[model samples]
Structure formats: structure tokens, C-alpha cells
Target chain A: MKTVIRSTTLADKLLFIALTTAAVAGIFYSREAMPKGSDVIIEVDGRTAYTLALDTDRVLSVPGPYGNTVVEIKGGRVRVKEAHCPNRLCEKQGWITRGAIVCLPNHIVISVGGKTENLPKGLDAVTG
Target chain B: MKAVKVLTVLLLLTATAVSCSNGPVEYRKTKPLMDTIVTITVVSESDRKADEAIESAFSVISRFSDKIDFFKHTSELSAVNRNAGIAAVTVSPETLGVIERALYIAKISGGAFDPTIGPEIRMWDFAKKVRPSDEEIRKNLPLVNYRDIVVDRSRSTVFLRKRGMLMDLGGIAKGYAADLALADLKKEGIAAGIVAAAGDIRAFGLKPGGEAWRVGIMNPRQKSKADELIATARLSNKAVSTSGDYERYFIENGRRYHHILDPKTGYPAAGCRSVTVISDDGIFADGFTTAVFVLGPEKGMRLVRDCGADALIIDRDGGVHTTPGLKKMVAFENGH
Candidate 1:
């Protein structure tokens, strides 16, 4: 059987090329805007409850086994604002820009996550 | 047109390529145990399976911690300390094994990392910023002899010959717990993972894409948060640990007093700022870091070579030193 085909116009080719280029550029642009600093992740009882940008200053009351673990983020740093755990070790940790702040009695873990530009392999752990 | 069709196909292909980079999702859980945050990361096909493996790993670490906790009144180590100078205290095989390793390190390190430094450690409360009196340190120094502790491997009993002598496995127990956690992960059939308990890290197998786990050594004198790491090392089926003066310390009169004490002086080891040891066994790496810190760079490197382990030492002046083996494995951040 003979096949019938429609010929493409220059305008149609230009439109298709422009759209593809724009789509590819958009993807790359989004990747660049991912995260310059990091994100504060709050986990309660083995599940994530909040993932907020570190640049934003906010106070979050995350509920856990015992009570709310008050978390504060400011100036790209995170801390345990308040916790009901008897030891208050988390509060004593003060401000941390990386790693984690854990309130064991509350079953809460606050960690920093995002792309660290220089570390291409990504840090599995930090030993001190 | 045909050109449009070709471009559409190319667009689909690009999207697929972009999304495929994220091969397998990782399941990670962090909990506070053994005086630090213990994070277990597993790359698994199913979330439920990963979660089970992680929980089992955590349970294994928790149980091991209970057996060796120096502060916990009911722990086996506590029982042994309670029976010091009295009689041999019976312990589990696991406890005996850890104690044996501690003793071995103590012998090799020439008692620099003695398990009997417990009496001195208890005197200085880092949290309260309290320092013990000179008299107290001098008194406890004599009791800090690793030779005083006797172990009976046949019967799994440990004895301290001195009345006030205390055996604190804090230096080495966490690494052993991390090693156990990794074993649990393997037993659960998790392909690749890392068990990190603060400064003690045990990594095994390649990641989902056959890449090794990368660990950063925290700079002892980090100027900023972004400049946390002095070096990074790629590890697979290995353990890397760091003992840093920065971890626990208090500054008084422009001098820093840290927790890692030299058994000879009953004071903080001042030769090095931090010592990072990499070894096939987590317990060895963890204990060696403390030993090396107290031994200084020249002597520490000798001990590292004798034990067939690698070390990265940051001296009191913030100078970087590494053994030949570690120099080949680690990538320095500042081109050291």
C-alpha cells in the first residue's frame, strides 16, 4: 500500500525546535535552583513530618511520642527550641548548622539535608 | 511533521534520562543511642523491608549498648566496675569480646587509651563545665592502669584488681555497636548501607549504583559551617573514626580541656587536635583514634603502621599529617 505524508513547513519546524530547547533549559534551570544552603528535615517516630528550607526563619512544633519538640530555624542554622525530655540534651546542643539534633525521649530527629557543592559523592557521615 | 515526531521522541528520551539518575530510593532512619545519633541508611527495593532491616539494626545496637553502658547502673560493665577489687564479674560473650578488644588496644597503645580511665573521666563534667582538682586527677591516675584488669575468655569474666578502678568501654564500644548494626543490616539482606554513630562510622558494600560511601572528617578548627570537613574518604566494607578535642571540651584561661584524657597524666591529650583512623574493624578504628591523639603525630603514625591501619592526625598547631596508606585513600579539601 502507498503511504500519504504531509510535508513540514519552516514555521512548524521552528516552533518545535524552540519548544524543545525551552523545555530542556527549564529542566536545567530548576536543577540549578534546587538548594544553595540546605533543608531542615523533622522526623517524628521514624517518619518525616516537615521539610522546610533552611534560609527561612520559622518555629515548628513537631509532635512525637512524649510531646511537642519545638524546633527553630534561623540564619541557616537549626536548634531545638524546647523539648519535654528530662535531660534537655537536645536543647543543650544549642545551634547546629549540620548533622542532627535528636530528642530521644520525644522520638524526634532534626537533620540537615541538601546538595553540598564541593562534595560530589555526598557525605554519608561526618566523623569528629 | 517527521521532524516534530523526532523531536518529541528526543524530549521523552531526555526526561527518562533525567529521572533514571535517581535509580533507587534510600531508606534512612536516625535515632539517639549510645550517647549520639545513630543513623542507618539502606538502599532497598521495598520500603517495608528497608524499615524492618533498619529497626532490627537499631535494636541490635541498643541491646549491645545496654550490655556495655558505663553509666547505666544495670549494665554488665557497671556490674564489673561495681565488683572492682572484689571478684570477677560474669558477663556475656559479647561483653567479653568488646572488653578483650579494648584490652588489646590498651596494650598496643601502651595504656594511652586505657579502659580504666573511667575514674578520671567521671571527675570532669564537660556538660557542667567543671574541671576536677589537681589532687583528684593525681589520685585517679594510679587507678588508670589497663594491666590491673584481668579477663578470663574461657569463662567470660572480667576482673579489676584495684578497689576504685573503673573500666569504661566508651572509647571502643560504640564502634563495635556500629559494626554489629552493619552485620544486622547484612543479615537482613540489605545490599548496601552505612551505620553511623556519631564519630564512629561503619560502611559496607557499594551503593545502588556501585559507588562507595563517602565520609567526611570534621575539621577540628572549622571556621564556618560550610567548612566542616578537612578531608573526605570513599569507603566500602570499612570503618573510619575520629577523636577530636572539638567533640567535648571546655575553654578555660585560653586553654582547652577535652574529654580524651591520657591515662598517664589524667588530663586531656594535648599532642593532637584530632585523630582519624581507618581500619577493617570498627572497634579498632574507634579505639586507635584516641590512642593516636594521645601519642602525637610521629609516634601515632608508628602505631598506626604497626597495627596495619591508616591515620590522619591534626596536630595542636592545626597541621595535617597522614600515614602513607591514608594519604592514598583520602582526598584533602584544602590541598594538604
Candidate 2:
């Protein structure tokens, strides 16, 4: 069956599609400015070495060379669940969002969406 | 037009928050040149780039991997070993810097931290291993005066007064690199990270989880195991370095000859098996770690304190002597 469409309506539809695409692209490219309120917790080898909560402006640091891992907390899952460093794998594994973050080598994991990662990686481990 | 303006404003805000980005970026780096397996984690937002920059810097300063390292050559020191007695020779900038730091440590240790022990080290032959004659030791003893070896920073010059004198910075260079990397990371927009070069390390900043960097001081006696958790520090914009003899030493005729040699006597300093130096500057830790090995804990502690540096000395008897402000960092139950 043939469908009749108005020329003016078609032009409006095209403009709407273009505007929608531009808005989505703009948001995706400039995402860092989107006020990411999510936080994270780092567990190395099943040990909670860091409990990071991200909100405003902050940077963090923590030790490394960990392997073998276990993560806790719900909602935001901790990755890097296993490694070789006597359950100290959290240091070796990678970061984790509510979605994913894990390091197979060190079994390090950063849990996301569960807690706030306000501190840097190494602030709590060292005295400086 | 309003939406466009908002997007531009947001872009500017992210740019302003470049160093302020606390996004947990796991840092994993490896380098074959320094013979190190290094892994660093930072909230720099781009942990991948941080690792790349550090590795790149190591390549830039590597003496073992590049031809440019010849500029910082210790060949003159080797030349002294070849020519038992000659007038002082000029040295390169890199050599001069290492020697100057060694001399500084020497003065701090009050002769205990001498750098002119090159001849003595050659006699003992810990690096290669072939003991020299007693006559050779006597001859070299006169040559091992750190005070005699002079360095002129302005002119970038060094002179071995007694001729056969040599200066080795095996203690401090690695520490310097670690400090440099941490500093470099900050300069390169990585305000949070750590650098461990052959066990000489330093860390700065906190984890995204609001915790400090927990460095594990491996057991000198046991490679695979940690002796005890000597310390877990915040590194809060600081550097650290650890020197030990359990791995790099020679057991000759029931005697163990380690690399940490005293400049005055040409022998390994007695009193400690390992010395862990924690300082704001990696270079100081490097020079002081060896200085402590030469100076012993009492004088070493004094020298380190005078220099505004900190230390953790694991004594020959397996005791730990931590600095005044470092006692809290030393977790002996889980440290090396």
C-alpha cells in the first residue's frame, strides 16, 4: 500500500531527527561534565584497600601487585574476582563500574555505583 | 543556541577539572630495561596514558638501554680502577650529580657514607667477585677518601683527588628515577600514582576510594613472601626507596659481601641487612639508603634526620628501627 505524506511534515521530521542526533552526540562527547555522582570501592585480593566515593573534584591512588580476589557489595559489582597474590588481587585487577572492571593478572577490582570513591588511590595506604 | 552554549560550557568545565578528575584509572605498566615489573593505579582519569608516559620517561633516562647513557658514564670510575694511581679526572653531568649526592650523604654520615670506596669495592669484587690481595686493599684504603673526591656543580665537574677513586650511586639513582616518575606523573596530569624501580619507590595521592597507597615491603630473606608489613603510607605527594642485601650479595668463605659498601673501610657496613628510606625526594632516599648501610643505624638515623629524610632499618638481628614520624607507617607484623 502507498502512503501519502505532506512535504512540510516531512521537512519537520527531518529537522527533528537532526536535532535529536545532535543532542545525543553532544551529551556523549561531553560526558565528563555531566556531574557524574557515582562512587567506587577498590578491593584487592578480597581485601577492601580503598573505598572511593566520587562526587565533585577528587583524585586518588593505591598500592599495586596484588592477585587473587573476592569483591563484596551489591548493586555495583566489584571485578577482578581472582588472582595469584594470596587474595590480594584487587590491587592487580582493574577498575569496576556498576557494569564492569577487573584485572585478571592481579585480581584487583574497583566496585562502582555501590559506594563513593572520594579519595585518591594511595591516600589511605600511605602516611606522607 | 542555548544547548550549544551549554555544551561549550560543559567542555570548559571538564577541561578545568583535568587534574581534578578523581575517576579511578587503574595503572598497569611494565618495563624490561629497569628489570622491573611495575604496576601503578591512580585516579588520573586516564591511567592508560599515565603508564605510557612513565615508560616513555624511563626509556629517555635509561643508561642500559640507550646509547645516550654514555653521557652519564661511570667509565672514568672504571678507568680509576684500571690505573691504580693517577691525577683526578673530570666527570659527566650525570656522573657529577650522582657523586655530589653521594658526597652529600658522606658529609651527613661523617665519613661513614663515603663514595670513594670504589677502589675498596673493586678489591672486594662484589659485582664480579674476585678478592684482591691484602697489599691491594692497603693501597686502595688511602684512595678511598670521599672528601678527596670533589664535585663542582656550576661547572658540572668531578675530580677524583687520589686518582684510583671511584664513585657508585647504586643506592640513589633508582630512587631518583622513582621520584622523578612520580613527579613526572603529576606534571603530566597524573596527580595520583606511585613508582617502584627495582624496589626503590615513592607514591603520592589517594585512591578513588579515599584510601592511601599500601606498598608491600617484600621480605629480603624470602623472595616470594613478605617478611612483615613494614609500612602502608599515604605517600601523600612523597617518595620512598628500600635497599636490601639479601638478594644481591656474595657468600665467600662463610662471609657474605653485600653491595652496600662503606666508603672508608671498603667493606659492607655492619648492623643492618636492609635499609628502607622514605623521603620527599627519591634522590635523597637513594643516596641515604646506601649511606645508612655504611653509617649504621645510629649515625644513619642522625644523617637521615638532619637531611629531613626518614628511614626504616631492619637490623642484622631482625629488629626494625623506624623514624620518629614513620612509626605509624611501619606495620611490622605484615612488613619486610
Candidate 3:
């Protein structure tokens, strides 16, 4: 009986140590694996029309009902380089490292960062 | 002793597993409607349910937009305009409700927000940067009056008293649409969501982790990236609408002419740069923002307080005025 009790104690301690290690590993893995500011996502008419890497330098021409809106991404920043809409307010918005640039007339949304469960930091929506 | 130790570990492990299974997943869908992008975000337990709810909400909003579009010749509001002084035009229940609400706001604001400003609005072309002559404004000013609108609730019809008077619902329709979409979402079993149409936004229920939705107000004079947001408000079960001169305007000879016309002057209101109103209902928030913009900061804040709503007004000289209840919720970017 004494020998059996010692072995049972050993098994319980082993199980406890194993579970603690697994929990710690999961926490580290989730933290490291999550991507931040991964890509520039441009949506046209409610669809993901373009997903460009933030590290690359590229200019994309997005077509809308009105005309094509030119988007330029460079040096970890993005902006609407030119727009065919009459207001040209999208072009005047300039560059942004985070948040979204919306062209209401053309129905285009250019945003930075990966889509997460929480709303984007600082700005979930902008009202003017 | 061994059983107790093993049971403790099993309980902790079960708790973590249960939490992971019940974690909320967010779904978002955006579409172009009412001349702006309408985005609906909902948190649900399953993707299929969220997709169906979002689709239904969008359909509801689309149907509402078709009825009240100011530019569409076949819209119900246009039908009422065409029949002005000729006869009453029967409209949908949704249209009647929105028109009734518009008249209420018009009365309370003392005609600062008149639905009959369509004739005056047509005079100025913001896209062409054309400023109408003072004589043209004077000719149209007489047609811009809220008293001219007549709604017969029993007959379910709308009539304008004057032959040339036109009813434009551009100010209040978007917010009403947002409210309708949210109601549809709730009917579909969505407990938490946000519906945003341009400057009109409505939020209900808590976000993930029980956090209130954070909404940022755009700076009227945003010259660069750093000045994007003037302030932010944490809101739940509330609606917010903002009217700004910078939204649709043209500058000629250092004079600015915006889309939100004053009924009395038949020209862009010059009192405030922007006005943001928060209320329990989206219709009031939307309609009152335009009314408050025309009323300026002092009178606007007073009217907002009277309506049991909150507001943040930015005057022409870059001064900020906020209602008492909203002072703590609004966090100014520059700590103003």
C-alpha cells in the first residue's frame, strides 16, 4: 500500500507539470503568431478587391462605377494618389499609417492592418 | 490527496475549454447604398447565422433607401414633390414615419431645418463650384418653409401646400435607414452590432469583451494625418450624426458655400463649422445635427439640451462647445 501511494503521488505531479507547460506554450504561441499591420486591404463595392503587402512599393488602379481610383503604397504607408471623382477629396486625404481612407462617391475603402476581433485602434469609424 | 490534486487540474482545464468554445466571432459586411458605403458589423457564435442576418439587414436598408432617395425620379418622396398643390400622394408607412419625424424636428428647431428646402438646394452646385446669384436665392427662399408640408395620417398621404414647394429628406433619411437596419438585425437574433451610413452611425449592445463602441469625430479642418480625429466618444445603445461644412462645399473668393442650406437665408449656414448630435434614436440624431448646425453653438446647445440629447459643436472660429452630459465621454485629441 505504501509503494502504491508513492507512485500515485508521482503520477499526479507529472500531470500537473505537463498541463502547466502546455498552457504556457499556448500563450506564447498565440502572442507571437498574431500579425499586426500585415497588409493594405482595399475594398470596392463591399468586396476585398485587393490585398497588397505593406512592405512592397506598388501602385494599384481600382475601378469603380465612376472611374478608376489610383492607390499608392510605399515605405509602410498608403494614400490615394489620384482619383477620377469630381470632389477629389480622397486624393486630398493624403497618407495614413493606420485607419481607413474612404471614397464615398466611388465606393472605395482603403485600410491598413489585419482584421481583428476588436475594432481598429483609435478609430472604429470616423464621422464628420 | 492524489484525487484532490487531479480534480483541481481537470476543473481548470475545463474552464479554459468552455471559454474558448464560447468566444465571440465578429462578421462585417459593407455595401454602397444611399450614395454612401453602409457597413454592418455583428458578433455572433456562428458564421452562417451572422451572414444571413447581415444580408437581411442590408436588404432592409436598401428598400428604405429606394423609397426616400432625393435624386431618384421614381422615389416616393419625389412623387410627393410632383404632386405638390395638385393632390396628396400616398406613401409607404416608413416614408410617412420619417416625414412626420422631420416635421417634429422642424417645429422644435423653429424652422432651422425645413424639409421644403429642395428648391434652394438645387440652386447651388457644389461640384461645379457655382454660386447662385442673390436674386436667385431670394426667389427660392419663399418656397423653403416647413409649414407648407401637410401629412394626413388617416389617409396615409403627404401634400405640400405650395405648387413649387419640394420636400427633400436628404438630412434625415440615412439615419432612419440605419435604425431600420439595426432593428432587422436584432429581429434576426443579433445581440451586438453597429450600422454606419456615412456620417450617421448607430450602435447597440456591447462589443467583444463588454467594451463600448468607440467613435471618432473627424476634424473639420484636418490638414494632415495627425489631425484626423478631433475627439472620440464611447457609446452603447446610442446613435450619432455629424453635419460639417467641409463635407460638401466650395470656396469662392474666400467664401464657403456648403450643402446644408439655411431655410431663411437660402444659402450655406455660416454659424458653425460642424455639429454632432447624439440621441437614443437615429432619426433625431440625424435631423437635429443639420438643425443644430444652422442654429449655431449657443442656440444649438440649448435646443439639444431641451430635446434630452447631447451635442458637440465646433464654431467657425475653431471654438468647441459640448453638452454637459457629453463632456466626460468625449476625449479630445489635444486634451482640449
Candidate 4:
């Protein structure tokens, strides 16, 4: 009777150890599974002008108040190729795989990722 | 009996782990409004409640935008501009409140940030990539005086004493909208959040895990590198505003002319690459940034000191000046 009881306790302890390990692994996996953005959104004058896949390679001409701003996407990166805005600040913004390129004068903005994921974690908003 | 006790302990551990993993989540949303992107972020246990709170905040921002948008012909501000020098226009209480705050700043800044500078601002052609001739700027300078504005508190009316005197509200409107959005969020029982309109930002309460919000000040010289930070500040229940020559400007004959025009000279204010102000009031911070940028470092720091606000001013020569209080709060980035 004593041997039977000891064997049952050992079996239950093994099961408990397995369950705890699985639960800890599950928690880590969920955290790593957070979704990453696969698209880039371009807005002109506060309106969506284009939504391109990050895997695609293309050049897009977006018209704005100043003139046409040429945007290029290559190697999963997007940037302003050229701009008619006086400062050419948009063109100076070389390339972005993440984050945003904002041409305030042209009223153009290129954002990486989906709409909800545009802002990075821990940042509520960026001011200036 | 030992087996049963081990099973009970395992179940309790699992429960604790799951509960800790399901801690409060951060919800954030950004929408383009009022000529800039407005982002609101909140911490809540329920996603549905967070969505509702953000929506409420955005609605408040939209309402304020409608009241003060100068580009929109149907806006109450446009109505006021249309009736300038002809009749006193009755504005909404909110509009009156913003205008009143603007006038007060103008008074304190001594016309460094004048709302009636609209006529002068319209003279510059940033879209056309051209600078207005000095003669044209001179012709419109007389129309940019804040003293010419007349306000009737009882009637909530505003009038410009001279013809072509326009009220832009560009300097302070974003801050006012941010203030309103924060109030709306608080009303909706949001314990902590941030309301940011362009460069005007107001943070309230504490972030999840009791951490203060971290804000990065952009490197004004390196406009192309949007991720480059000149410095970072940790904030809670405060407002920060930055005015820089890089925002809107045209380079002509090797001169960079920006949008923050001086009311006295009718030209872009120079001497500082950027000016950042922090205070409890968003409107005051916004107005002071423009005012201090025009004032340069010495006088600007003096104004900041007098106003009892913290400031960081970057000069055209690549020097960084900070108030004693700000020196404690900011961490300068590499190569700053």
C-alpha cells in the first residue's frame, strides 16, 4: 500500500512540472507573435493616396499643392525621390523601412506599417 | 495526498502567470486633422473602452478645428476674417476662449507671436517656392498688429480695427485643440493618455507601469533624418511645444526663409534653429515657442525664465541652451 502511494505522488509531480513549463513557454510565444506591418500608407493633403505592399518595388508620383512628389519603393524601403517643395526636405529624407516621412509644405506623409501600427510602442504620440 | 497538494500549487502558479501576462494594454490611434496628424493614446484594460475614449477625444479635436480653420471658408474663423474691419462677428464660446488666450500671449510676448499677422503670412508663397518681395512685406506689415484687434467679452465678438487685418490662430490653435482633447479624455474616465497635434503635445497621468511619457525632440539641422533626436524629455501631466525654422520654409539665394514671421519685421524669425517650451498649459507652451524662437537664445531664455517655463533653445550656430529646470529633465542625444 505504501509503495503504491509513493508511485502515485511521483507521477503527479511530473505532470505538474510539465504543465508549468508549457504555460511559461506559451506566454513567451504570445509576446513574440505580435504582428508586424507589411504595408506602407501614403497620404496627400490628409487623404489616402496609396497603400503599397512592402515587398513591391515601384515609383509613384503624388500630386500636392506645390507640385508632384516622386516616391520610390525598393528593397522593402520607401522614400521621396524628388519634390517640388522649396526646401527639398522631402527628398532629403532618404529612405524609411519604418517610421514616417512628412513633407509639411507639400502636405504629404508616408507612413510605414498598417494604420494602427504607425506609432511605435511606448510612444503615445510624437510632437515636433 | 502529496500529489493533490502539488496539483493545487501548479494551478495557482498558472493562474498568476496568465493574469500577469494579461496586464493593461496600450491603445493608440492617429488621424489627419486640422492640417496635421492628431494621435491619441490611452492605457486601458478593455479594448472597447479605449476605443470609445479615443473617439471622444478625436471628436473634440474636430470641433475645435472646425471653429478655427482659416483655410476652410465655412469656418467661424473664416467668418470673422470675412467681416474684419466691416463688422464685429459673434464667435462660439470656444473660439472666443482660444482668441482670448492668443491675445493674452501676444500681450505677454510683446507682439512676438501676433495672431493678426495673417495678412503678412499670406504674402509668402511657400507653395510656389518663392519669397515675397520686401516691398510687398512692408505694405502688409501695418496689418499685422495685435493691438488693432477688438474683443467684446460679454458678446463673445471679435473685430479687427483695420481692413485686411486677419487672425490666423495658426500659432495657438493646435495647443488649444490638444487641451480640449485631454479634457474630453479625462471626462470619459481615461486615467492616462496623450493628445498630440503636430508639434503640440499634452500628456496626462502616468503611462502603464507608472512610467512617464518619453518625448523626443527632433534634430532641426538634420531635417531628413526624422528619427534623429537632439534630446529626449520625460513628461507627465505637462505640455511641450517646438517651433523650428524647418517646418515650413523656402531657400532663396541661399537663405532659408521659414514661416514663423516676426510681427515687427514681417520676415521669418531667425537666430534659432528651433525653440522648445514646456509648461502646464499647452496654449502657453505653443505660443511661447514661437515667441522665444523669434527672441533668440538670450532674450528667449529671459522670457522663458520670466514666464516660469522650462525651455531648450537651439541656435543657428548649433549651440543648445537650456533653462536650469530643463537641464535636469532632458537627456541630450549623441552628437547633440
Q: Model 4 — interface RMS deviation? A: 6.6
Q: Write down the RMSD of candidate 1 (Cα, Å).
A: 4.2
Q: Could you give candidate 4's per-residue lDDT for residues B219-260 as a string of tens digits?
A: 787643344567888889889999888766768889988888
Instruction: Please tell me which model should have the higher DockQ, number 2 or number 4.
Output: 4
Q: Judged by lDDT relative to the true structure, which candidate is superior, 3 or 4?
A: 3
**TM-scores for every predicted model:** 0.83, 0.60, 0.77, 0.78
Task: Please state what fraction of the native interface contacts candidate 1 reproduces.
Answer: 0.55
What does candidate 4's lDDT look like per residue over A1-128, in tens digits?
46644667666767767767786788788765654445788987778888888779999899888889999999877878889986565575456555567777788888774245544333455455
lDDT (Cα) of model 1: 0.83
Evaluate candidate 3 and give its CAPRI docking class based on DockQ.
Answer: acceptable
Chain A TM-score, structure 4: 0.63
Candidate topping lDDT: 1
What is candidate 3's CA lDDT for residue A49? 89
Query: For model 3, how big is the CA root-mean-square deviation?
Result: 6.2
lDDT of each: 0.83, 0.56, 0.83, 0.81
TM-score of chain B of each: 0.94, 0.77, 0.93, 0.93
State how far residue A95 of model 1 sits from its true place (Å): 6.0
Separate clash counts for every candidate? 0, 68, 0, 0
List model 3 lDDT by residue over B230-279, tens digit each.
89988889999999887667788999878888899988989999999989
